[model samples]
Target chain A: MGVSIFGLAWRSLMNRKVSAFLTIFAIALSVALFLGVEKARNAAKDGFDNTISGTELIVGAPSGQINLLLYSVFRLGNATAEISWPTYEAIAARNDVAWAVPISLGDNHRGYRVLGTTQSYFEHYKYGQRQSLAFAEGEMFDDLFDAVIGSEVAKQLGYEVETPLIITHGLGAGGLTDHDNRPFRVVGVLRPTGTPVDQTIHVSLEAITAIHVGWETGARNPLADNIPEETIRGFNLTPRTVTAVFIGLKNRATVLRTRRDLNTNMTEPLLAIIPGQALAELWQVMSTAERVLLAVSAFVIAVGLVSILTSILTSLNERRREMSILRATGARPSHIMTLLIAEAAVLGFMGAVLGAILIQIIFAVAAPILSAQYGVALMGTGPGLVDAYTIGAVTLAALFLGIWPAITALRRSLADGLTVKV
Target chain B: MTQPIVSLSDLSFAWPGQPPVLDVKAFELNRGERLFLRGPSGSGKSTLLGLIAGVLEANSGAVHVLDQDLTELSGGQRDRVRADHLGVIFQMFNLVPYLSVVQNVVLPCRFSKRRLGEVQAAGGAEAEAKRLLARLGLSDEGLLSRNVTELSVGQQQRVAAARALIGNPALIIADEPTSALDADSRDRFIQLLSDEAQKTDAALLFVSHDGALAPLFDRAIDLAEINHAASIMEQA
Candidate 1:
C-alpha cells in the first residue's frame, strides 16, 4: 500500500510548527469576525421583528411608513401629529377592530422612554409569537400614579416595586419640564422580552394626562401649579391625545379595509399601516448599512486570505531543501505540489472549524451583554449551512493560495535535485 | 549477457538561456560496480546526477537506467523508475527532520509498489528498515525512535545509507553522502555502504569533490577527464 500523502504533508507541517499555527490563528480570527458580524446582524433583525410582532396595524398622523415605525416601535424621533382622544375611541369602537391600545410617548424618566398606556395594554399588547407580557415582580399598575417598569429599566436603575420616580415632560436626558408634584411608584417589573419594551417604563394613560393638567400648550399654568396634590383627584384626567395606537384586527380579512378606512375616511389626516409591511420598508432603508457592514467583513476575510498566501509563500523559500529531499526519495514534482496544497488545505480546514467554535463561544459569553445593551438575543445553535459554505470557500481559497508555493516548490525541486544548496 | 545498470550516449544539457553544462559523448556503469566520480566545483557533478536520476532531461541524446530509456519516459515515469530501481543519498537533506528514523528509511517504499513489495516480502517495510539500520551499525531502538534533528551527524549519515539500501534498489546514487562525517566515521560509512551494495548487488555511483575517498571504490573517474563541456567552459 502506498503511504498516505496527507501523512507526509502533516509531518512536513509539523516541522514548521510556528508558521503553521500563526497562519491558522490569523485565518481563525478573520473567520470569527466574519461570522460574528453576520450573527449580530441576524440577531438585530430578530430583535426588530420581535418588537411589535402581534400588532397588525399601527394608526398615527399621516407620515412615512418608516417614520411611523421608528417613532412607534423604536421610540425614535418625535411624532409630527397626535390622535385625539375621540378619534382613538371611535377607532376602538369600530366593528373591525379587535383591540386598540393607545401609546402616549414624549416623556422621559432617568433616560428611559416613558410609555403611557391603559390596563388594556397589558391585556391586549403582545410580542414574540403573540405572547402577553408577564410581570417579573408585583402586579400590573392599579392606580393612576402606579407605574410598571420593564426589566432593563428596573435592572439599570435598581428600582424595586414602590420605588418612586418622577417623570419629565419631554423626551431626552435632561428635560426642564419635570412633573415634581406627582411621582409614580413602581408597581410591577416585566420579564425580559428582548425587545424595545425592555427599554420603556409603562404607566397609566390617566397619569400621563393628570401630570400635564396644570400645563397649557407646552407651558406651565401658574394658577394650577400651586394647587395641592391632595385636591388633584377633583380634576378631569381624560387623555386628550396619544402619539399612536397599536391595533389588532377582528379578522384577517379586515386589515386592508380598516387600514384604508383609517387613512381615507378619518376626520383628521391619519394613516394606518400594516406593521409588518412598515417594518419591512423600514428594514429596506437599513439594509444598505447592513450591506456595507457585510462588505467590510468580506474585505477582512480577503485580507485573511492574503495573509494565508503570505504565510505559505514565506515558508516556501525555507522548505525548498525539504522539497528537493522529497524528490530524492522518489517523490514526483507533482507530489511536492500536492504536499504543499494539502498542507494549506489542512490549515484552512482547521482554521475554519476553530473559527466556528470560537463564534459559538463568543455568542455564549456575549448573549447576555447583547440582550442587556441592544436587546438582541443570539440563538446559540451550532454552525449552519452558511458557515459551512464560508468554511468551504475559505478552504478552496486556501488551496488556490497554496498553488503559488506549490508551483515554486515544484520548480525548485526540479532545478535543485540532489544538490540542494540549502 | 546482463545489461549495464546505466548508460549515456551523446548526452548534452544546458540551463534555460545558458550554455551547455554537460556534454558527454559516452558513459557506462556495469551492474554491481562501485564507481567514485570526482569533480571540481562547477564541473557539472550534481548536474550529471540530475541527468542520471532522470530529474533533468537532456537537450539531446539518450540516457538509460537498468535498460529503461529515461529520455523516452514522461517526468512521472522517470519518478517511478527512480522509486523502483534507484536509491539516492544526498550530502545533506538525507532525512526529513520531522520523520522518525524508520519513517525516513521507509520513504521509498511509500512511493514505489515494487519497493514496498520487496520490504513486505521481508516481513514489512518498517521491519526491513530496522534490519537495514541494524546492518548499518545503528540498531538502538532509542536511536530509531528519535527525530532526525536529534541524531548526530554520523548517525544521520548512517540513517541515510540505510534508507538508500532499503528494498534493495538495483542502483544507488550517493552525492558526497559523507561530507559531514568525521574521517573515521566517513571510512566506516563507506565500508558499510560498500558491503550493503555488494550484498544487494546494486551498482553505486558516488560523486564527490574530495579525492581522499576514491580509493575505497572499485573504480574512479575524474569528471574533468570525461565532461568535454567542463574543459570548453574553462577555456572560454
Candidate 2:
C-alpha cells in the first residue's frame, strides 16, 4: 500500500543483479540482431529498387537476361558476347523507340568499372524515381579522350578535373595490360546516388574505341605498330560492337510489340526484358535468404525469453521464502504473481532500450561497408514506429511467458505454510 | 461489544491420505489478550498458524478470525481477510532479503489498503515504520538503510516485530519469532513486541516451545494439554 509492488519487484531483481544483468544482455543482443537483420533487408530492397528505374526495357546480346543485366546494369560478371553496332543502331531507329544508350564494358580504372557511352547517357538515363544524374564538379566528357568519373571513383582515387586516368585492358586489380598511351582526362565527377553508377567511370563509346586501335587478338600490338597518342584522334574511332543497350520507348503501349520485333525479327540475335520482372526474380531469390535470417533472429529472441523463464523457475524453490515473507506481511498469492511478472516486464523494457543502443552501434560499423560492397544505403539509426511495435511485442511476450513461473511459485507458496524454514 | 480476536471450535485437520495431525475442541483469545501457546516441533503448531492466518483449509469445524468463519469464505476472500486483518511473523527469514529495514516494516501496508489508510492517517508509512522500529531499538539511519539480510538475528527479529505491529492489525501472530535470539535479547524482543501490540490494543498469539518465556505473556497454554491429536499421535 505504501511501498509499491513495482518497487518491490525491482528490488527483488536487484537482489539477483548478476542473473538479471545476464538476462537483459541476452535479450538485448537478440533484439539488436532482430532489428539489424530487418534494417539490412530493407536496405537491400531499397538499393536494388533504386539502382536503375524508368527505363522500359534492356536490350543486350543473346545471353540470358540476368547475365546481361549483371554485366551492363550491375557491372558484375563479364559479358561473353557483344551485340553488333548495326543491331544497336536498328533498335535506336525503331518507330516506337525514343532513345538508346550503348554500354560497352571491358575495361577498369583502378578496380572501378569503365562504361563507355554517348552524351545521351547523361541526357536520358534515370535512376531512383526518374532522377537525373548531376555533376558534382566539372561536366560530361566532350571528346574521344575525355572521361567522366563517378562519385566513388573520384572520392576513393582522389580524382578531380584534369586528373589523368589510365584504363586497364580487363576487369579487377592488375589486369592484363594498361592503356598507358591513350590516357584520358577526367572531365566530370557525378554526385553520389547510392547505386552502382557511383562505381563507374564514363566515357564516349569512341573512347573505348580509340584505346584498342593498336591492340589485336586481346593483346598489345608490337612497339613499331603502336600509334602515338598525338596522332590517334583522326582514325575513324567508332565502336564496332557494344556489350548492352538501354532502350526507352516514347510510346509506352508498344513495348511488348517492339520487344517481340527485336527478339524474333532481327537479323542479329538479341534479348529484350522488362527490368521489373528481373528485379522481382532477384527479390524472390533474396527473400528466401531474408526468411532464413528472420527465422534465426526469431529463435534468438525465443532463447532470450526462455532464459528468463529458466531463471525465474529455478529461483522459485529458493524464492519460496521471499514469497512467504510477502504473504505473511499481508500480501496475497496474487501479489506474489504480480511481483514475478512485473520483474520480467521490467527486464523486457530494459532489453528494448539496450537493443536500441546496440543496434545503433552495429549500424555505425555496417553502414560504410554495406554502401561500398553492396551499394545498399542504411539510413535510420534508432527505434522507429515499426521498431516500437516490435519492442512492444517482445516485451509483451516476455510478460506473457513469465506467467508460467509465477503460477508455479504461487502454487508452491499456497501449499507451503506461512512459517519459513529458515 | 468486546469480542474474542480468534475462536476455533471442533477444528480437525490432516494432509490428504494421512492420519489426523490436529484436532482441537475449543480455543479462544479474548480482545487485547496476549496468549502464549507452547508446543514443541511436530506438534502441528505451524498447521494451526496456517489455518489461523487463512492460508490453509481445515478439514472440519470452524476457524474464525475477526468474527468471520474462514471456512465460509472463498480462497480469495480468505486472502483478503488475512491481508486486511492479520500480521504474521515466522521464527526466521522474517524479512524480505531484498528490501531495506523500513521497506520490510512497511510491507504489510502495501497489501492491505485498510492498513495503508491507517498508516497514512498516522502521518505516512515511513514515519510510522520509523516510530515502530525506534520503539524496537533499531533507529540507526545507516542500519535502517541497509538490506534486511545484513541485520543480526536480534535485529531481524525486532524488524519482523515492527512489521507485524505497523498497521495495528486486529491480531498479531508470531510463531517462535524469538527462537533464533539469545536468552538476553529474546526476553527483550518479547517485551518490545508485547508493549507495541498493547499500544494498538491488538491481541497477540505467540507460539513457542520454550516454556521459560511463557511467563512474559498474559496467559499460557500447553499444546499437549489441549490438542487431543498430539496425545493420540504419541499413543499410536
Candidate 3:
C-alpha cells in the first residue's frame, strides 16, 4: 500500500519460490543459448574475414574461383592442376607485382597439411590486421631437410626445435605413405594466428620435388630404392611445378589489368581470385542458415516468456482471496494491476541478469575447445552495445508479458472486490 | 453538528441478469455510533456493504459515506474515498499470508495516504500498528514477528481489527468477522473491536447473522425489518 508495488510483488513471488525459480531458470538457459550462437557465428565469420591481409589475389590453375581461393588460402580442397614453376616465375617477375609467394601441397605430417614455400613466404605473409608472422622459437627453415611447423602442429605433436618428423607421401593411410627415410628437422614453430595457417607444416619449395624423386615407385620400406638425401639434394633440387601462388600487386590500382595479363598473357592457363570477394560469396551461402539458427534461438526466448505468462495466469485463481483482501484494505483495481505486473517484471529482469551470467560462463568453457578445433577465436569484449540491447529487449519483453496477468488481476478486483467466494 | 458517517437513501442494486439484491429506503449511522445489522448469508448483507464501500454502483439512488455521494464520484475517486475513510475486516482468512503480524496490522495505511499521515505523529505506521496490536491483546514479541497465517484465529481477528482501526478512518466495517471464532472468543473479539472503535471515535458497522452477539452494540436492526428487497427475495 504505502510501500512500493514492486516490493509487494516481490513478497508475493517469495511466497511461491519453486515456480518463480523455474521461470527465471527457463529464461536464463534460452538467453545463454541465443547469445552463444551469435558469438560462435560472429567468431567464425571474423576468422574467415581476418585470415588474409595485405594480399589482393590468389593465383592457381585454371579452375573455379572458389576452388582456387579455398585451396590456395584455406587449404580446404585439392587443386585441379598444378601451376608450372616457369609460370610462377613469370608472375613473380612482373613489373606490377610487388612480391609473390609460391606454395606446393601434396603431403601431410600426421593430419596437418605440409606446405612447401620459400623464405619469402614467411616475410610477405600477413594475417589479422596486417600482422606479420613471428616464430615462437628458433628461426626459419634454412636447409633442404628443415621444416617450420605452425603453432597448433607444434602444440598437438609436441615438436621441438630439433625434433625430426617424417612427412606422409599424401593424404594416405597411416604407415603406408610415411616418408620415414626422409624425416625433416623442425627448425622453427610459428605463433598462433587463429587461422588455417596455424595448422600447417612449412618446408622449402625445392624439398617437395626432392622428396618425390624416385618415390613414385611406392617403395615398401623407407630405405628401399630411395636415393640418399645428399645425392638428391645435389641432383637438381629445382621444382618443376607448384600447387598455387599468392600474388601481391605492386599497386592495387593495377589489380584488374594484372589479373587480365595473367589470364591472357601467361603461357599456361591460370585463374586468379580476390580472397575478400570469395569470402563474401561464402557468407551469402551461409547467411540463410545462420539466420534460421538465430530465429530458432529467439523463439526459445519467446517460449521462456510464455512460461512466465502461463505461471502468472495459473496463479490468478489461487490469489483471488488475496486480491479481495487487498481490495478490502483499500487497494484500488489499478493497485492490484500494478502489483501483478511488478511481479512478472522482476522475474523477467532476474532472468536476463542470470542469462548474462550464464553466457559468460559458457564462453569461458567453450573458448579453448573452439579455437583448437576450428581456429575461430572468440574475443570476449565484455558487455558491449549488443549485450545492452539484448538485455533491454528481454526486460521490455518481460514487461509486456507481465501485462496479461496484470489486466486479469485488475478485472477481478473490479468485478469481485468485496465478494470473493473464498 | 457532525454529519453521519454513512447514509443511504432510495438505493436499489442488482447483479447483471439477476433479480434485485438490495432495495433500501433509508439507512443512517451517526458519527461515533456502533450499529449492528443482522443479515445471514444470501441476505444481501454483502451487497449493501459493497455499495457503501463504493466497490459496486447502485442501480438507482445515492450511497453517501463520509458526507460524500459515492454515486457521483469516479471509480478512482471512490477508491480514494474508501481508502481515506473506511476499513473492513472479513470472517476468515483475515490476514494476508505473506505479511507478518505488524505488516498485516498496518495494511490500510499502505493504501490510504491520509491514514499514513494520521499515524506519522504516533511514530509512523509500524509503531502505531504495534500500539494498536498491544491494545488489542496481541503483544507477544514472537507472535508479532511470525507469519500472519501461522497465528491462531483469535489472534488473526485482533490483527484484522488493528488493521481496520490503524488509519483512524471515519467508518469501520466488520462483516461477519467473529463467526469463525469459538463462542467464548467471539464475544471477547467483538468486545475488543468495539473498544478499539470507541477509542478511535469511529462509527462501526458490525453485520452478522448471530443474534446472541447483538447486545454489545449501541444499536441493532434486523435486515428483514429494514431491507424490502430481502423480504421480496424471500417470497421468490
Candidate 4:
C-alpha cells in the first residue's frame, strides 16, 4: 500500500514536471543561500576566536584594548606608544616567563605588514594553541638580511626564495625614511595559518635596525650616508624601543596574576590583555551583526518554505479530479493527505541535501580567493555541527510550511469526492 | 424474493439557500437487479447517486445499503461502508489520469479491507483486476500498465466499468458513465457493465439521460417523477 501510494505520488509529480521542477529549484536555491551564509558566518567566528589562542598575554605601552589586540596580535594598526627594549628584556628575564617575543612595527612590504621580531617568535609564538609555524617551501630566516614571508605575501607578490624585496619605513603609501637603500632577500615561506600571520613579512630585529642605520633620530642625516657599513654598525644600533611584546606564561594559571601586575606595577604606562578575553569581547561587539545575518538567512528560508506551500496549495485545485479518482479507488481522505505530506517532506529533504552540497561547491570555488585576500583558509569537508543545525532547522521549517497544503488538499479532496459523479 | 441491496426512504437534500434538489419517497434495488434511472440535465441524478453511495446525508429518513443504515453510521464508517459495498463510476472523469488502467481498477480494494479480501479471495487482486480488464475487452498489453490519460474515451469508460465490478461489491452506481462515448461505444459500455454486474451478482444503478438505453435494464424509473422536489421546483 505504501509502495503504491509512493508510486502514485511520484507519477503525479512527474506528470507536472515543469511545475514540480520549479518548486524544487526554488527550494534548492534558497537552501544553498541559507547554508552558504551560515557556513561563512561560523567560519569567520571560528577563525576570529582561534586568532591568538597560543599566546597568553599581549604587552604594549598603554593603549586601548582593541589597539593592543590589533597591533600585538594581528600587526594591523601602529602602536600609540613604544615600550622600551629594556622593559621587554626585563619582562623576558622573569622566572614566570616561559618565552617572550618582542615585535618592532612601523614597516610595510608592499601591502603586507612587516614585523621585526627575535628568532623566539619562530620558535615559541603560536596562534591556535601550540600551533608552531610550518614552512611550506623554505626554512626560517638564517641571516639578519634574510626575510621569512607569509603564505599570502609569497603568493600575492610572486615572491620565492632569493626574491629581493625592499621595505618601507611607514605604514601608509608615502612616509619619511622610505628605507629604499637596503633590500631584504626572501629566505622562507610559512604555511597557510588562516590568520593575520599568513599575510605578514617577518624579519629579524637586527635587520630592522640595519635598514634604519643611516637615519639619525627618525630623520635622514647627510653625514650618515658616507659612513662605511662597519663604521655605522659601531654606533649604537640597538633598538631603543619596541612596539609590543607577546608573553607566554610558564603556567596557564599565572596569566591573570601577571596581567594584574603589569597593569599596576609597571613604571611605564602599559596594558597587558589576555588574547582570548580580548577576542571574546570583540566577538561580543560583533555578535549583533552576526545575529542580523542569521535572521536574514532564516527569512530567506522562510520565503522558500512559503513558496513551496504556495505552489502545492495552488496545484491542489488542479489535482481535485486526480484526488477524487483516488478516493473512488479505495483511498481514504487521510491516505491522500499522507501522500501529499510525504511528497512535501521529500522535497524538503532533497533541498537540504542540495544546500549542503552547494556550500561545499562555494568553498571549492572561493577558498583560494579567501586565502589570498583575507588569509582565511577554508576547508571543504562534510557538514559540521553548525551546518547540520541549519539543515535540520530549515527542513523542519519546510515541513511546517507544508502542513497547510496537505490539510488543504485533504479538505478539498473530500469535497470533490462528494461532488464527483463517480 | 431476494433482499433489497439498496433502500431509500423519504430522502430529501438541497443545496444551501435553495429548495430541495431531490426527494425520494421510496426507492429499492433487489440483489443482482440492474436498474436504469433516467433524468434530464440538472434533474439531481448525481445527487441521487450521492445519497445512495452515502456520499450525501439525506435531510429526512434513511438511506440503507446492504441493510446498513448510512445515516446512523459515523462519517468515517459511512465511507467504509461505501468502500466495502458500493462502487461508483462517473461519466467524464472516472479514472485518475496519472494511474495506470490496472491501478485504477484495483483502487476500490485499497479503501476497504472487505473489498480487498473479496478480490483476493477469488484470486489475487491483481489477477482479478487483469481478468476484469480482459473481460471488458482491454488487451493484456493495455491492462498491464498504461496511463488512463492515454486511453480513448471509449477505452476509459470500459476501464471505469471494470473498476466498478472488481471487488464484487453489493451495489454499483454509474453516473452517466457513457455520456462521453459514441452510440456504439455507449451500447458496448452498458453491455460490459451489465455483464460484469451479473458476473459479480451485484445490483447496478445506472443513471443516464438517454431514454433509448432504458430497455436494457431490469427496471426503469424516470428521476423527474421519483424526485418530488424537482417537479415542485419546475411547477413553481
DockQ of each: 0.55, 0.71, 0.60, 0.41
Error of 2 at A42 (Å): 2.3
lDDT (Cα) of model 1: 0.86
What tens digits encode model 4's per-residue C-alpha lDDT throughout A219-307? Answer: 77666567776665565657888888899899989998998988788778779998888888877887888888778877877777777
Model 3 over residues B1-236: C-alpha lDDT tens digits?
87788989999988888888788998999999999999778888988999998889999988899879999999989999988888898888877788778877787888988999999977888889989999989888998988888888889998999998997988899899998889989998899889889988999999999987889999999887768886455764
Estimated TM-score per prediction? 0.89, 0.96, 0.94, 0.88
Candidate 2 lDDT over residue span B1-236, tens digit each: 67788999999999789788889999998889999999888888998999999988999999989889999998888888888888888888888888888888888888888989999999999999999999999988999988777889999989988889887898999999988988999999999889988999999999999999989999999877768886456754
Ranking by lDDT: 2, 1, 3, 4
lDDT of 4 at A43: 79
Q: Determine the C-alpha RMSD for candidate 1 after optimal superposition of all C-alphas.
A: 3.4
Model 4 C-alpha lDDT per residue in residues B1-236, reported as the tens digit of each score: 76698888898888667798888888888999999999887888877887777766778878888888888987677778888888888887777777777777887887778978888788888888888988889876843566778788888888888888877888888988888888888888899889889888889999999999999999999987778896555753
List the lowest-lDDT window of 10 residues for candidate 2 chain A: A374-383
Candidate with best TM-score: 2
Stretch of 10 with least lDDT, candidate 1 chain A: A373-382
Q: Interface RMSD for every prediction, one decimal?
A: 1.9, 1.4, 1.9, 2.5
Error of 3 at A245 (Å): 1.0
Residue-level lDDT tens digits of model 2 in A71-156: 87888989889999988898899888999988899999888889999999998788888999999999989988899988888877
- DockQ score for model 2: 0.71
Candidate 2: residue B203 Cα off by (Å): 1.2
Docking class of 4: acceptable
Per-residue lDDT over B1-236 for candidate 1, one digit per residue giving the tens place of the 0 to 100 score: 78889999998998889888889888999999999999876888889998999888999989999899999999999999998988988886678877888888999888888998998998998888889999999999887878888899899888988888889899999988888888999999999999999999999999998998899999999887777886446754
Candidate with maximal DockQ: 2
Clashing pairs in 3: A1-B110, A2-B110
